[model samples]
Each structure stands twice: as C-alpha cells, then as structure tokens.
Target chain A: MTRLEDMVGAAVRDLADSAPNAHDLASVARVRGRRIRRRRQALLGAAAVVLAGAVITPYAVLDGWNGGPRPQPVASVPPSTAPVVPVPSTVATAPAIRKDWWAAPVRLPGDLVVTSVGRREVNGPNGVTAVAPKTVQEGNVALDRSTGRYRAFSGGYQGFDGAPAGRYVMTDDGITAQIGILDSVTGQTRQLGHGSGRGVEWSADGKTLLLSLLRGGVRLIDAKTGAAVDREMPDAIALCPSYCNFTWLPGGEEIAIAQRDPRVERSEALPDTVRDIRVFSVATGKPLRTLPVPGVPAGSAAWSPDGRYVALLPDAAEEDGIRIAEVATGRIVATLPLVEQVRFIADDQILTVRGLDVGVYDLTGKLRQSSRLPQDFLGRGISLGRA
Target chain B: MKQSLEDEFTAFVADRGQSLLRIAHALTGDRESAQDLVQGALAKAYARWPRIHGDAEAYVRKIIYNDRASAWRRPGRRNEVTVAEVPDRAAAGRHDQDVTDRIAVREALLSLPERQRAVLVMRYLEDRSVEETAEVLGCRPGTVASQASRALNKLRLLVGDRPVSMGGAR
Candidate 1:
C-alpha cells in the first residue's frame, strides 16, 4: 500500500476501535432469532400452503341478457365555477403588509390532517400564561392575537408568532425556516420563499426579513418592497461549517449571528461550538464587532430585549453556563450552569427551557419561576410570549 | 420454506456477520454504532427471512445501507466535537501517520451524500456487482453506476492522491 493509503487505513482502524461493541451482531442475532422462529411457525401452517399455491381465481359469470358486465355511459356536465382564486405567489416577492398578506384568520383546511395533539400550557416571565387548545399539533396551528383567529401555516411545520405584527416562522426539520405572514385580523396565510434556507428573523420595524442561505451568507428581504439584499460574509465568518443561526435585536439595526469557525475539527456533522458572535449593522452589512464566545453551542442565540446582553447555551461545561456577555465589552458577565436554550421575555427576565421545564431567569443567572409542560410539548416547538 | 429459511439465515450469519459489522464500522466510523447497524439489519432480514433467505446476505446488506442512509437523513443527529486549535505545522505533521490517513478516508466517506456513499461502499468495498447493489439499494443499475461514479469522484477530491484504486483489495 502507498504510505498515504496505509496512514488512512490505520486512522480508520483506530476510529473503528473506539466504536462501542455493544451494538454488535449479537443483538441482531437475538432479534433475528425471534423473527425467524415466528416466520417458521407461520409458514408451517395451512396459510403458507394457500400462499404458495394460491392460483385460486374467482370468476364471476354473468348470464343476464346473455351479456357480461357492460360499461355505463354518463352525460358530461359543465365545469363548476368556485371563482378560482389565483394560486397566490408561493414566493414572497411583494412587500409583506397586513393588506398584501393572503391567508388571514385561516382555518384548518378540510384536507389538512392533524397528526398528533396534546394539552399544553406555556408560562412566561411576568406571570403571562397562555394555554393553547389541546387539539393543536406541531407545525400546524398558530394563534394570531391581532385577528383573534387560529391560522394554519401549512409548510408541514407550525409555530406561534412570538413577535408582534402577525408574523411567524415555520421550520421543517427544525433547521430550514419558511417565512409565513398571517393577516392579524383575517388569518389569511401567505408563505414566502420555498427552501430559500433558514434563520428567518424580522426587523424591528417588521419591514425587513433575514434569511440564511446554504451556499453562504444571509439574505435580507425588504418585506415592504420585496427587494432582497444579499449580504455576503467571508467564508471564514461562517458560523458552522454548514450553516449559521441568526437572531435580530429588538432595534433590528444590528443582527447577532452564532457562527462556528468551519476550519476546525467538528465533533459532529454540525457542532454548536460557536467560537464567535458577530454583530453586524443591517444597513451596511458591515460587522460592527466580532466577540469571542467561548463554549457556546451552535444552536440559537437570544439577545436581551434591551439588546445589551447576548446569552448563549454553552457547549462546554467548564467554559460558562448561560453566557451573559456584554455586546460592547465582549466580556462574559455571568454564566448560568445547565441552561440549554434561552429566550428573552422582558428586560430582566429570560425564559430558559431545559428538558421539560421552562424557567424564568434573571440577568444575574438566578431562577425566578418555573413551570412544567406536558411531556414532549416543549420538545415539539418552543417560543416565549403569545402569538 | 420455513426450514429452508432457518438454515439459510443461520448459514448466512455464520459466513457474513463479521464482515457486515466491519462495513458498518466503516460507515459509522464508530464500532458501537456499526454493531448496532449490523444487528438491526440482521433482525430486519431475519423477520423477512422467508422471502429474504433466498439471498439473505444481500437482503441484510440492503437493510444496512438503508439504515445508514436514514440515519444521515435524520436532523440534528450530527454531533460536533470541538478540538483545540493546532498550529499549522503540527496539523501537517499529524497527517503523516497511518491513523490520520484512515481518519481522512473515514471523513471523506462520511462527507459524501448518503446515497452516493452507500453505492460506493456496496459496489467497491463490499465487492457487490452493480446489479446486485442496485437491487439492494432499491435503485436501477444505471443509478447505482452513476452514484458509484459520483462517489468515486468525490472520494478522489477528498483523498487527493491517496491512491483509491477500485481494483486494489487489502
């Protein structure tokens, strides 16, 4: 073998060596043994004989009028008019406004099937409790507070509007975000961009949208003009080797992106090991500051409502817990241990969901209040505040 | 049919179980996962033993390929490991070893799109005929050839001049 080939072979062998043997052929043998036994028993019965020699055909002979079954002819009818509403543009090219949006107060389509539903309640920081209907399934229903209507955003996944102005992002596979604009009053639904990529964030004015593209960088869509602004960051700035998750500050002037340095050994195909948090000016697409975020996993990063402190769940235990870093100093002000995902409910209170319990934590990393969600509700989709 | 299947399954396991585990290891780049995959495939084949026993090894192999492909399809299954940054010189030196070379190959295999990887593994490493691979993968022979070709091209790109000749058997 060539030296290079030998080297690679050895490396592969080492990797294989490290793999646990618990998943070995014996488990399969046990399972297969049972199956084989069952199949043998089933085949030993008369059913096997019937299946093997099943040439038995059923023939129906019709003697009526000395004829076989005859085909019936029917009269053609005129096409019915339901006022075919033009198939609304799947692409959200036009400006997204309350008037321009299509499906408001949208009802669950008759053909829309509900996969699964369970009773669930979410409690926010300031004693804000919202109990959704027990019949709601994941990726199907969202409550639009403006219209007081439950709109079904059907890209196969559903989410509630945590932000105001009747907008919600539906994510399929928990990665790609499909932008949906629901009329707050009518529940009309219009989906924007198909597989345009994920990380859809609304500008503070709710006029612009931010989306991440697979090839590279992020796309800024002006919901008002339908003009898209592609802001290309250097390949070195890629959050993860594959993709980055983005969140817009309340001001929307600056966007916070959690990105990992791609030119590193990644533990998984995608790792939340975000080495840097970059705050970019939305107007110029110029990075305002590049702050080193040590130990933050590469999931979603939440900005404080005031936009002063950015919090991330640490991927490494020794680095920090809930990293409350100052945007200006790039200094980690506080670390809260064991916090996995964080969302800001108010200035002082933050909603932290770890496992099944959602707790409100202060900036100082103290738990204030906690609430229990029915098993797997938080697992489905989690967001703070009401739709 | 029942007796024939039992005999076939038992014989197939005795002949090919270890090899399946090895292939699973290569695919997962982890022994534990590889074992799990092999076991799962065996169970699936055993369950359909009456039908699968005609070509039990091929049937089990198809299950392995499908299982690996589905695992790749699952979202958030990729685990990212953080390695402390090594200086460029050290990194280059680290690649000089046999283990590093294997690591490179494993990574290259993992980097391929799942279907392409399955085709490449089944055709090249497992030494299955194109038609046999197509049947196992539930694809046309043409698709198997195309996927294998594409996969080889990708491996060439990743392995660079590492001599991944298809004819070479170790």
Candidate 2:
C-alpha cells in the first residue's frame, strides 16, 4: 500500500466509522426539492412581472439580450473542472420533452393570461420580522433576467423617502425589524416600520394588504384608500405564523385560512399543527367554506382558475403529494404522485417539480411533458419566455 | 425497485448518510460546512433518483466532488479550509490509527487546493484511476493526471515520505 493510500484510507475509514446521521439525504432531498420548486415558480412569476414592467420601464423593453438569441443545445460540451465556463456563447436546449427537457426563451405574448396567483411577485426589495424564534433580517432582491422584476431572497426594503407606494409584497427581513415595500415599477424599497417587522402581503387585486401588528393580532388594510378592511381578521384559531398565511380565492373577496386545533388527529402526511382549512369572507370575515380536514394537515391551498377545485399541499412533513378537492363539497377529487412543490401554469395545466426536472401535468394528474432546465437555473438568474 | 422512492431514499440516508457526512467533514474541515456540503449534494442526487438510482452512490459522490471543486473557484471560500486537529488514535476509536502519520497526511492534504484535495481523495483513498477520476470530475484524463501528480508531489514534500501510486489503485 502506498503511503498516500494509507493516509487517505486512514482518514476516510475513520470518517466512515465516526460519522453520524447528522442529516438525512432523503429528507434533505425533499426539502431541497421544495426549495427548487419555489425558486422555479418565483422565476416564472418574476418573468411575468418583468413582462409587465416591459410596458412601464423603458430600458427594460430595449434590452436586446433579454430574449433576443434563440437557445439551441450542442451535442456535447467539453469537460472542464472550472465552475464557470463562458456562457457557451450558445445556449443549450434539451433534446426532447421526455428525453431531455428544455425551457427556451421565446417571444411570450404581450398579453399574459394568469390563471392563479402563487408566490409573492419578484418586486424588488423588502424587510421582514419573524415572530417565532424571534429575529430581524434585512432583505435582498435579485432581479430577473427580464426587466423590473426581483426576488427578495434576503436583504431589506429600500426607497422610503421619495418613492411611489402602490402595494409592495413583503416578507420578514429581520435585521432592521422594519417592514419594507418593494415597488413593482421601479426596483426600490421603502420602510413601513421597525416594530412588528414582517412584510404585509398584498391582495391579488393589489387593493388589500395583510398586516400583522406588533401590538396585537393580524389586520387587513385597503391599500388604495388606506382603510382597515378588518382590524382583526378574526384569527379565532390563532393558526397564523408571525404574519398569517391565506390562499386567495378567485373572486378576491374570500380567502382560505389555516385554523389550528391540537385535538385534530393527523397522519404522518399532515403538518402537526393544522386541524382544519377554512374559507372566510374578506367582506364579513365569516366562514364561507369549512374544508373537511383530511387525516392530514393541508398547508398550501391553491384555488383553481374556474373556482371548481382547490389544490392542497400538505404542510412540510412528508412527500405526500398534492390533493385536489372540490371547492363546494370539499371532497378530494384526485391525489397526485409524490411531488415536492406545485404551481398552476394554465387553467387546465399544473406545473410540478419531479426531482431536478419540471413536469407539466394536466388536471387529471397525467404528466404531459417534462423539461430539463439549464444546469445552473435558479430564481435570480433564469427565466423562460413562452411563445 | 425493491423499495418505494421514499423507502429507498430513506435507506440510503440511514445507511450511507454518516459516511458521506464524514467525507464531507474531512473535506470542509468544519462540522456545519460539512453538513451543508453533504446535504446539498444529497439533495441534488435525490432529485434524479429515478434515473440515477442504479448508481446512486457514485452519482452522489460525483456531486460532492464537483460541488467542492466548484467551491474552490469562488473567491471567499478557499480560506475556510483548515488543517484539522491532530486526531488521538484512541479518539479515532481504533488502536491502529497512527497519530503522527494521520496528522502528517491531514496537513499535507489540507496544504493542497480543493481540486487537488478532491482528486487525491478519489485516487488514493477511494482507489480511483486516472480515467475514472477524470470521468467523475468531468475533466480530461490529462487534467486528472497532472492534478494527481502535483498533489502527490506536494504530499511527498510535506510529509518527507515515499508516496505510493496505485494505478490499479481503485
């Protein structure tokens, strides 16, 4: 045995022996899968915002490289140990939908038809105050390849003094303990306040904002007129995080909110905290729909475009896929195969993350096509232009 | 095929997670960073489970090497490498661990760059060949040869010992 071999063997063998299950790859995979899915969805949403910004921001539309060159994959790339090779000068496309999926940048129609609202828009900059395990963080924003869109993965809100204030999407940027609003038009930040530091979410229409006051419970405010729709949106269940999480329905007058009940028995699939999913009127704050709690805790609820069904992603516990339920009757219409994250592309089609690949699945849950993204695709750097 | 995706994944995690973490810890020289590196690689590997299941271990090992290789290129990351403390043979849970030799090896290995460190680990510790190491690292065989030669030469200089080369090594 060579001395080098002995040394390496000694080190590796010791490591293998002393190693503990510090973290599980399976669980880590599931978590990362969800993170990747979120990033993809954020990229998609940010692209739309950039598309919208193209109308408003002059420099945005003029950028030729944004979607000018058509991406075509080469047969093979020469091997290199370097992390970054020049952007290939030519974009690589996947071979086929099933064999190798590719998201090519095309001239997306100027008129975007959005069936559902998923993540907060990639509007630039924001602040957040997380109540649990209490800490403050400043937010940072990464602009999409398209113009005027940004994802505040971290860093805090900007542009408070002389900035236009429509309604900005806010998350917790704990450092400042200040809630910041990111302007949709210009990538600028403005402070809302330091106390109760979480960012308030905006309604789909951009008319309403969800606020969690440090003094008390949650409050819903009318953004345009600046009036409280409800000082206390009746957190009767107290199932909210530092802020509250609600799935906005089609009409925008109602939202499905989480109601916590410890007595509610749950399977390994459900988030342990959730006991029920309820829909309440934005106008009256009254229960409109009380979903039958599956033996599992359903966390993220996506109401279908036509208002026929609601898709529920169980709170992060297991890879128990999404559940599609009838809105009126609250019956589980269909169950999907295990997926890490899900989003709605068109009304009839849903996008899912199946490992590193993204699959387009129909309402019936049959996969229509799968696409392989560029190896380095992430929320901050990548966007797909649809034809 | 014998187990569900989750089951199989769980088995890999339970059975192989520790060893992978140790390798990562050795590479990173810190517990937190090692956990991060190993988990990140596992997550990437986990996503392709359906296609790569047959060679999952190798697939994951490739990711670890690549991730570490890539990290070396980043500006601020290289300074994080530490020559780990001298291991007490007793602390290593074995009577055979030669503290003097192991510390010498650790120092020599830490003295090299990340890519060299990765190449050396594969070639010497794991018993991989020039071609296999190149294949795993997505580099040319010539590149692997030069990297291995340089790393071994550095090790010999650092430790003042005859370095054994294993061509049929793996």
Candidate 3:
C-alpha cells in the first residue's frame, strides 16, 4: 500500500479499536424493523398478517402504525356497543414495554371504529391521560397520535387548524369536509353540521369553525349549533394574486397573515411578498397591528400554541432550519432541524419527523421523546397532527 | 411468516451489526452519529425486506455511504469539524508521535470531505477495491480512485509526517 494508504489504515484502526459491540444496536434495530415494516405495509391495508410483538412496546415511537386492521366506520352505533377487547393474554407474563407519558400504542383491530371526534378521557396504561379517539375498543386503539382511533378521519389540513384531535373537519370526496365535535369524556359524536366553507378551521375553544371561502371571504360556523356567520376580507388582504397563508391565534380573536407579492410572480424573492406581516382582527375583519417579518415566503408561517411565536421554515435565501420568532419581538430565539415536518405539539414542545423518527422536543431544544418510523413514512403519509 | 421474517432480520443484525457499527464510526467519527446513521439505514432496509433480504448488509452499507455524503451537503446541518488550525510546518523533523498526534491524525481524517473520507475508509481500512468502493458510492471507479488520492494527500499534510506511523498504539 502507498504511504498515505497505510496512514489511512492506521487512523481507521485507531479510531475503530474502541468501538462498542453491536448487540444493543441489534435489539433496537429489530424493533425498528418490525415497526417500520408494519408502517410500510399499512399502505397496502391490514389484510397482510404482520405478527404482533409478544409484548408490544408502549411508547416505542410513531404513535399510529396500523399493522393489525383498519377499523370500519360505524357512526350510528355507540362506541361501547362493539365487543369489549380482552386484555392481551401476554400482559401478565410479558416483559416490560417502554411507556410514553401520552399514550400506550397498541395494535388496533378492525372493529373499534371511530366515526367522529369525541372527548373521552382515556387513561392510558401507566398514567397516560388523553382524549381517546372514539373507539369501541378504547383500551386497544392504534398508535395514531393525531386522531387516536378515528376511522372516518378521511382528510383535513394537517397541523394547520389542529384538526383530528377533539374536533376535526374532514372531506372524503375532496369536494366537502365538515367539522365534527365529540365529547372528550364519553367519546360520543356531537352532530355539528357540515361547515359550509372551504378551508375550515376549528377555533382554539373548539366552539367555532373558521373557514375560508373561494368566492373571496372567511366564515365562522358554530361547531355546536351549526350557526353560520360570514365575514369578507378587506380588499387589502383579499385577491390572492400570488398566494395567502394564515393561522388563527390562540384567543381565536385574531389571525397572522402572510401575503406574497402579486407583481413579482416568482415566490422566493424578498420583493415578491409584503415586507410586514398583517395581523387581522376576526371580529372586525380589518388589518390589525402590522409586524415586520421581512423575507418570509408564502405558506410557511405556523403559530405556536401559546400564540407568542410563529415557527417559520427556511425561505430560499435563509438557513435551512426551523426558525421560531417571538411574535412581539420578531426576534428568532431558536433554529432547529425538521423544518418541513414541524408542529408545536405543546406550548414549548414541538412534534417533528427527523429522518425515520417522530420526536418530541421541548422549548429549550431538548429532545424529550423520539421514535423512528419508516424512511418513507412522511412520503407515504404516516398520519401526523391533521391530515 | 412474520416471526420468520423477523428472525431473519434479527440474524442479519446479530451477525453483521458490530462490523457495520465499526464502519459507521470510522465514517462519522462519533458514536452517536454513527448509531443514528446505522439506525436510519436499517429502518429503510427493514421497510424493503423481501426484495433485498438476500443481501441486506451490502444494501445498508451503500445507504450509509450515500447518506453520509448527503449529510455533508445539507444546509446548516452538516457536521462541522472544528479543529485547532494545523501548524504551517512541523518543527523540522521533530514531530512527536504521541496520543496528541494520533488525535490530530483522526481529526485530519475526519476533516476531509465526507465522500473522500468514506473512499479512504473503503479502499484502505475496509480493504475494498476501487470498483467495490465505486459500487457502494454509486460512482465510477476512477472517481473513487481520485477521491482516495486527494484524501490521502490531505491527510499527509495535516498529520505532519512524510510516512505517518501505522503502529496500533492509538
């Protein structure tokens, strides 16, 4: 070997000499393999017989991986009407399974159908408190964190209006999507009418539905009584020449809007959009205080749960990481990876898909919990917050 | 069928996990990142078990190399190798061959572009032929040869030795 080649060999040998044995990695990889394979097969539907683990991990990762069966949509029958699921026979003898504070992931069978969003207090194994998705088998629902055991959870804006939780507006045929409210305690559906507007969004209080209409205006539909109120956008915010993206603030009284430059035609250039962000009052339908958030591209603004900050994904000329800027200061406090797949899971914690993993991180940018799904899970549409 | 497939996957990891981890460490220069890379590749492998089960290790190794290369390119996410700037010249013919020097050598190797570093690892420590490295990297044999050459020359400069010590002390 040449001198450099020999030197390279020496360096590699030195560095690798202290490497750890792969026994631990093997165990973890086996688990990851089973979970991801099940997720991939989830696209093919539940007819394929993927074996359940002897003692399924409680909080392994990726909350909803449907390996067993797709629950059918049974809206008329009450959730308790379906046959009760006996505890997994192995629970007593099975080894310890990892637990997440949120929920214990179990293989969902085809029978525990959920027709709409319901507010049933599901106490997960090991103190995981949740508004369980309306399911016949509340004790044995699937791992989908967004809609728990929701079956008619056909389609909605993912993570946009925080759908698929207690209440969700969904469209199966693409032409219409209605918002459904459920009792979080009983897991029973409340007959909220089909919100008659495009881009339907649930209010923070879950009492009102905010929808954007194509005819050029926004509407507020009562989620409980199905009352409708329409509001037209001021000409300044309307006429989406380039594009428009907006999100409701926590109080549900205001919205943060980003309107791109109508004249530039190209989307990325700083000149293509308004220099200052336009905040509009939902009650008045007029532009409120305008904050300077220059160079923000179209459709990249998501408000934090606390309404104190807006998370912005990187624009063309900016660094490629998620930037969280305080709405009051417009000063960016943190920049993190997972720009495209980021949602504020809590006031301080964000849920993100990094590589094959779905991880939860706190405001201090500390990774609190992370679980890997399949590599193409995002592309294959592993259900997240909304859609 | 599920148990059998899992058994096959478990067997593959048990047999080859250690060697793969070693390769990952050498490529990434850190245990955590190596584990991350390996887990990622293995997840992909598991996703496509039926088609590539016959030759899963090779497939995963290929993934590792490709991902390491791309990791170097991602904006604001690349592993920045922060090294004390190398001296312009080693004190004439009096460089000490100690632990510090070993560490410097490791840093110098890691400081190389990820593809170049991976090429050197494949060609030298892994003892792969130019063609094999090319196959793993999905590039021409000549490209692997060139990257290996550049990597070695850069290493020689940074490590400050004409014929660096190949002793296993480090």
Candidate 4:
C-alpha cells in the first residue's frame, strides 16, 4: 500500500481501538427490527389495535432496560368473567397514574407565599417536605407535605438550594462563613466544621458534599456527619478563571468538569468553547480521563442512575436535543430527537422537556409517554430534591 | 424457524460485527457513532434477513456507506471532529510518531467532505477497488477516482507527507 494509504489505514485502526466492544449491538438491532416490524403490523391492524389499547408486544428484554415503569394502564381492569355491577352515576372514575414531579406547577401566590421562591421537594422517596421562601426575609420556609404547614429556617444561600433529605448546609457570612448543616425536619442547626465556604453541592448519591471555599479551594465533607473527608480535589485547571462548576458522576467517586475558555467573558462562551470533558478521581485529585466532547455540551449534564451513561444538552446553536453518551468510553449512544431539558427518572428512562410538554423516553430515544407541563411550572426557577 | 433465523443472525453478527465496526469507525471517526452506524445497517439487514442473509455483509456495508453519504446531505453536519486538540509535533520517538500520524490523519480525514472521506476509507482501509467502491457508493468509477485523488491530495496538505518506510504504487 502507498505510505499515505497505510497511514490512513493505521489512523482508522487507532480510532477503532478507542471504540468499546459493542457486544449488545445485535440485540439492540433486533429490538429495533421488532419495532419496525410492529410498526408495519400496526399500520395493517389500524383501528382494531388502537381501540383495544394495543396489547404490549413481548420482545427481548435488554439487561437494565425496563422501558420506563410509568404511564401504566389507568386501571388493571382484569378480564371479567361475571356480569359487571352497574355503578351509580356519581361514582368516581379509576385513579390515574401519578404524574412526574415536574408536571405539577407551583404558582407564587396560590400554591406558595409570594415571598417564597425556589420551590424544591425534600425528605422521603415521595418528597414529604418542600422548601420555599418565607414571607419574612430572615429565612426560608420548609413546608411539610403531610401536615400542610410551613416551618421557617434561617441562613442558607438561595442559589445553592437543593440538598439531601431533611438537611441542608448553610453559612452565616460570605467570606468567613461558619458552615452549618440544618435539619429542616426538626428545627435544629448544627455547626459542621470550622471552615469558611461560598457554596455547597451534594454528590449524586447524597453521601458527600463539595464545599466551594470563599478564598478559592474546595473541600469534600461527609454529608451525614459533616466531617471533612480527606480526598483529592480537582486539578488546578478546573478551578481557575471561573467558578469550578462540577457535576458528580454517579456513585460519588468521580466528577466531570467541562473545560471552559476563560478569555471569553460572555456567559455563553463556556458551552460554546467546551471541547473536553475532564473526568477526575475524587480520591486521587488527578484526572482519570479527558474525553473529547462530540458537540459543544451545553447546560449541565445529567448522569444516568447507573452512571454508565450521561445525557448532555446540545449547544444552543443546534436544535434542542439530548445526546446520550456512554460514560466509560465517551461515545454518543443515541441522541434524543428534540428535548429542551432532560434528567434520569430511572436507569433506562429519561424525563425530557419539549416546549410545554414533559416526556419519558427509553434509552433508544423512543418516546414512551408525553403529557403537558402545568401552566405555572417554574422550569429552572425551581429545583426538585436530590438533583 | 423464527428462532433459527435469529440464531443465524446472531452468529453472523458475532463473526463479522467487529470488521463492520472498524470500517464504520474509519468512516465516522467516533466509536459510538460508528456503532450506531453499524447497528443501523445491521438492523436493516436483519429486517430482510430471510431474503438477504446470503449477501448480508455486502448489504450491510452498502447501508453503512450510503447512510454516511446521506449524512453529508444534512447541513451543518459536514464535520464530526472529536479530537480535542491537534499536537504540534510528535514526541522524539517512533511510537509517538505513530500516534501523531494517526491523530493528524483522523483530523484531516474528518475535515474532508463525507463522500471524499468515504472514497478514501473504502480505497485504503477496506482495500476495495475503485469499481467496487463506486458500486457500494452508487457512483461512477470516474467519480470515485476524482474524489479519492482530491481526498488524498487534501490529506497530504493537511498532514505533512512524513510517510513510514512502506512502499506501494496507488
């Protein structure tokens, strides 16, 4: 072969080596083939299948793919053998599936006090407590979902709002702020440690907290005991020129930082110039791998429940979509067609926002269910617990 | 019979999946995109496996080439450069030179138009003849020749001609 041809061939081989073994390619293809087949069958069956609610086709169940455990049948309504009992006209209809948390919008005056902003759910799997701003300017109000009452708490930055269940970290001052952890469930606050910090971030599992110091540095703290954990911090490049915005990879052992160009002052410059995703080991304080981002990954990245995959929002210049990428190899697995926002509701399912509608999509980027968001939904103005 | 067909398809994938992935990786320069491309072509082949299993590899390869070519038709998708940075010089060693050459070639190949990139990949990496490449890409032999010439010339310009001690006539 010509030297150029040989070099080109070698280059291709080098790139191919970086590609992880796609062992599941055949099964994924089979699943797609079945969908194509079923689509053709549906076209043939038409109204019959539509009216009958379409029997769920039995196909291969991929490992860790549950196709989203949501949008279930309105009622189980088992096959009836006997005569149906006639119900009165006043009898209520069957209960509907609970909507995703974001679907329910909270209005300022009606649902919450006008002074209270930044509504976020906390405590319990079902979110027993929701914290919002109080009428009094001194502190925030935590509303007990069960009791329908608000308890006010003092001293925490509204910007760093979301936290672990029943507790949130706060500081009394900006520069020499004494960090304290408050248990919103009980009216008690405990000093965490003798440290001065600017903001706090809870790891994905809520086991660790990343406290950004006022004088430029970060400390890892045990979320439960508030003791300083001896762990390595991100490299110097990740901290300088701008606030080190970090997104925790699942399991709280590593973090992914999208490198930014400090020279560009405009806010849009970060996502515009983001070319690499630097992954760091929290224990070693060293870079594990730097993956070249395919497109300019804009906004924050959402890690899948398994941490095996991450969903990144495309740059604003491109059409709205979620680029689902395998975390280990940094390969774009699938790009959801059109989504305004995305987060993982399950390991295999992602909650997506399209205009005013919120949709649930499987890993294959197929929409499972779609419903409109509430009229007063506070998109980024609010945060759900454990973000 | 259906189970047997699935089993046969699985066996074929096991045998030829990696080769197809390599060709796709050469075409798309990104692993996941390559896998997606291979999966897509394989899915198409699987859909008609009953009729096309005899020529499944050829059919899947054709799909991969055509899909990649079609991607060129979409505006603003001409380039899929995934390399974060281009090194100025190779380290003072032969192994480092190999890495540098690969990176430079990959970046240059990605910068080329999709059709030209396809032609070069098919000609050099897959070792397909001009006629075979044309047949797969559904183009004239003359078109393939011209595209390959332009792509090679551009690659030479993009990455300096520091060829290894390999020798052959194009």
Candidate order (TM-score): 1, 2, 3, 4
Better model by DockQ: candidate 1 vs candidate 3: 3
Q: Which stretches of candidate 1 lie over 4 Å from their true place?
A: A1-134, A137-139, A147-155, A158-184, A194-197, A204-207, A222-227, A235-243, A258-273, A295-301, A316-321, A337-340, A373-378, A385-387, B1-170
For model 3, the stretches where C-alpha displacement exceeds 4 angstroms are A38-387, B69-80, B85-95, B98-100, B161-170
Docking verdict class for candidate 2: incorrect
DockQ of 3: 0.15
Comparison by DockQ, 1 against 4, better one? 4
* Per-residue alpha-carbon lDDT of candidate 4 for residues A1-387, written as tens digits (9 for 90 to 100): 677777777776676665546567788788546544443444344211111101110000011111334221111212223321222122111122223322222211101111112322122232122243433222344433334343455424322232422344333232233455555456566665543322344553335666533222246777567778544342433322222334555555665556544454532112233445676667766766765544322222256545555675443222235677665555666678544345555555665543245556666676666654333332212222321
**Model 1 / residue B158 / CA error / Å:** 48
lDDT of 4 at B40: 70
**Global lDDT of each candidate:** 0.45, 0.44, 0.47, 0.50
Across A105-194, the per-residue lDDT of candidate 2 in tens digits comes to: 211111111111112213222212122211111223332323333333332222111111122333324344344544434545444443
Which structure is stronger by DockQ: 2 or 4?
A: 2
B29 in model 4: Cα distance from truth in Å?
Answer: 2.4
Over the stretch A1-387, how does candidate 1's per-residue lDDT look in tens digits?
A: 445434444544554444443323544465435543543443343122101000100100000011123211111112222321223212111112232122332111111111122123333343222344334443335445544444444433323332223243323321233445444335454555533223454443335656644333457765544567776554413343222435565455555555665556653212234567666666777777765554332232255544455565434223234676654444665566433346554434555544345466666676666654334333333332222
Distance from true position, residue B43, model 1, in Å?
A: 24
Candidate 3, residues A134-253, lDDT tens digits: the string is: 332222122333444323222221111223233433221212233344343343444444432223444544456555433334567675566778665534343232123344654457
Pick the TM-score winner.
1
lDDT assessment of candidate 3: 0.47
Q: What TM-score does model 2 achieve against the real structure?
A: 0.40
